[model samples]
Target: MISVVIPVHNEEKNIEPLFREIVAALEPLGEPFEVLFVNDGSTDGTAEVLRRLKERDSRVRVLTMDRNRGEAAALTAGFFHARGEIVASMDGDGQNDPAYLPEMIRRLREGGYAVVSGWRMKRKEPLLTRRLPSWIANRIIGLVTGLRVHDNGCSLKVYRAEVVKRVQIPHGFHRFIPAIFGVKNHEVAEVRILDRPRRFGRTHYGLKRTFEVLRELLTIRFVLGNRVFYEKALLAGGLISGLLAVISLLSSHRPFWAPGAFLGGSFLFFFVWHNLRRFNQAQKEGVFHVRELEI
Candidate 1:
């Protein structure tokens, strides 16, 4: 069985089309599957649309968030309720191809991969707004996380249920799940998927999302940050904190401010150092598993 989890944000119009295509893609496989749609506080008619979908198809289960919690949270909610041995996720805007799912599942099962991610080699979005930032961000994330997947931003990804259990996703971590999975040495495979122009709903991407992605990437790096990383962090923090403390000490107007800044920075430095030590000693759990359940 496979659990398909899709997170939708103000994508009411896309619901039916995506559902049909998903069904078309899965029907030939002749396997039991469930489609879980996580509605992230869609202010539009998305919730009502999903209700109609659920009524029409028993496999369609809608998880509604009271407020717009973002994709990562929605994904988390869907993940918890997914009852399949294999879990898959994709965008709700109908851009991702459901036909690739069978192949992805095959790669995960036969190719001995814990996760299979889709790559949109040819994106349809504009260069400056979508492609450019994705290209740069993918490179940066690849360098930082040391995972070699070509397209980290692509949402079409499949994870072995056990492998996904080991992953911890927070806000904004949706774009970097591959790297996060690599933390425990889980093997990841990438497959090419078709990217289509959205038939409905405006894109949620903007300058703000780019900045948010950058911040999340840094957070991932920090979580995966090692001894060497912390060493550099300590050195940088020490120097910056020391300089700020010293330079501000000379400021006769705000003399106490320097000490406070120094204290704050020192606390941060030691905190990272502490984490490094504890992380180094912690044992890494091997692949995990859960018994199959009815969807």
Candidate 2:
């Protein structure tokens, strides 16, 4: 069975049309499938629309959050409830075409890849506002994570159920799915897909989102890349600084630089210890708690 997970926020107008497109695209594959629409606390009638879709089709499942968490949280919820061995994810804005699902799945299987990401080579959005920011963000993400994909922000992607489910996607980290999977040594393949213009509401992304992506990118580099090496280096610096401070005091000619060095080293050691504790605690907690789930 193939499970398609879509995370939506205030996209009531596009839900029905997108659902029809999904059904049309998947019916030809002759396989069991399920559609999960995660309503991320939209104030509009998005929840009502999703409930209606669920009633109309048995294959449609709706997971409504109690409040607006974020896209990453919504995807995490959908993954927890999804029962398929293979899972596909796309945005609910209708910009992503459902027609590419078959080819993405086919490539995933044939190429022996854990993930098949959609690359929107020719985007239909404005070059200044949407395209330019995405282009710059993708480049920075590639440079930081070392998993260079053409489109890191593309929502249309397919992944093996086990591989994706094991990943810990924090709030606002949905854009880094390919990099997160790559850091764990998962083989990811990219397929060019059609990018359609929005048919309903305004885009949620903008220049502000670009800054947020940069902040999250730094966090990913620290946590997922060479965290242990950094921790050890800080530990050694802290110990050496302490030794110098003690020697300076015992020499009867205390150096003024020793105090500054000791303070800097103490801050570094505290920073590493504090982050290590927080990281361990985060591992034991879920990204988002379940408020309600409807099938």
Candidate 3:
């Protein structure tokens, strides 16, 4: 069985059409599959469309959130609810072709890969607004994570259910799935997929998301480094600050405020490092609240 999870927000016009495409794409595989549409507090009739799809097909399931959580939270909720050995995720905007799912799943199984990500080599979006930022982001992500994934932003990916279920996905971290899986030494593969232009609704992403991606990259780097890296970083900072403090005291015109500020910065680094260690140990439960479940 395969579980295809889609996270949708205010995409009423595209829901039914995308469902039809999914059904057409998956029927040829001749395997039992379930489609899970996670409604991320959509203001439009997206929920109604999902409900209708569920009523028509027993394999359709709907998970409605209490409020508008981001894509990562919605995907997390769907992942938790999915019941299949093979789990797959794709965008709800109809830009991702469902036809490529079978090939991705095949690659995952045949290649013994834990994940098979989609790569839209020739995207259909605008150059400056969409492609440029995505290109920069992909390069930065590859450099930081060392995975060299061609398209980390593509949502069309297949994963082993057991592997993905073990991961704790935080908000705004959905784009780093390849890196997150790679950190655990999981084998990841990518396949070229067709990127269709959006037929309805505006894009949720923009240049602003690029900045958010940059900020989240720091968190990814931190996670990849673990506790030892942070400890070393703090030690280095403390050493630098201490040296500066000594130099200030030894100077003829001692700037007392400079040393105090340097010492304060060192202390601040240690404080954040300590809290981050504690945070890693703490349980992160209930990150997403579901308003309704129709499984």
Candidate 4:
């Protein structure tokens, strides 16, 4: 069985049609499936529509929040509630194509990958706001993560139940799944999928959100980069050198020469100290955790 989890916010216009298309798209797989719709405080009669659809289809389930939470929370709730060997997720905005469901599952079952992400090879949205930003984001993410995924922001992806449970995503950090999963040695693959232009409401994202996403890109990079002890060493060396330099000046040693020597030597000492610290930490912990995982 496959569980499809979709997160929607103010998406009343496309909800019914998307539900129909998803049902038709999955029917060919010959596996029992369920669709879980997460309504993220939609004010546009979306909850009413979901309720009617839930009543009509026994295979459908609706999870509604009284207030709007971000997409990551909705996805986390869906993951915990899902009752399938594999879980699939797509956008509620109708931009993600349902047609790729079969192919994504096929790769997961046949190739034994923990996750399969959709790559928007050819987008159907407008050239400026939608397509261009997505293109630039994907390219920049590909370079930083070294995973070479074509679309980091595409909202179509499939994951094994275990993988979803293990991946820790903070709110607004869902787009960095590939980086997080890759660091943990989870097998991830990508395939080209179709993108559809919005037929209804305006895009939920804006310039502010785009900048926020860019900051997230940097966060992911720092999280995934190699941990070397040299960083800590450099810090220690700097402190020691500054102390020595001050002592030398107090003792009436050549002040100008002492400060320069202290600065150069401190930099070198700290570089080595930090690298050693990183090596030791890596040995102690199998994987890098920027913060305590329990939190």
On TM-score, the leading prediction is 3
- 98-173 per-residue lDDT for model 4 (tens digits): 8899999999889898888998866876677777887788788777777777777877999888777654455556
Cα displacement (Å) at residue 36, model 3:
0.7
Local lDDT at 261 for model 4: 90
Worst lDDT run of 10 residues, candidate 3, spans 274-283
- Candidates 2 and 4 compared by TM-score, better number: 2
* Model 4, runs deviating above 4 Å: 183-186, 222-295
Cα lDDT tens digits, model 2, 178-220, are 6765433358888898799999987887778876776566456
Q: What are the lDDT figures for the candidates, one per model?
A: 0.77, 0.81, 0.82, 0.73
- The TM-score that candidate 4 achieves is 0.73
lDDT ranking, best first: 3, 2, 1, 4
Model 1, runs deviating above 4 Å: 183-186, 225-248, 251-295
Candidate 2 similarity to native, TM-score: 0.82
TM-score of candidate 1 relative to the true fold:
0.80
Residue lDDT tens for model 1, 124-186: 899998899989988888887888778988989999887666544656666888677553335
Model 3 scores a TM of 0.84
Sort order, TM-score high to low: 3, 2, 1, 4
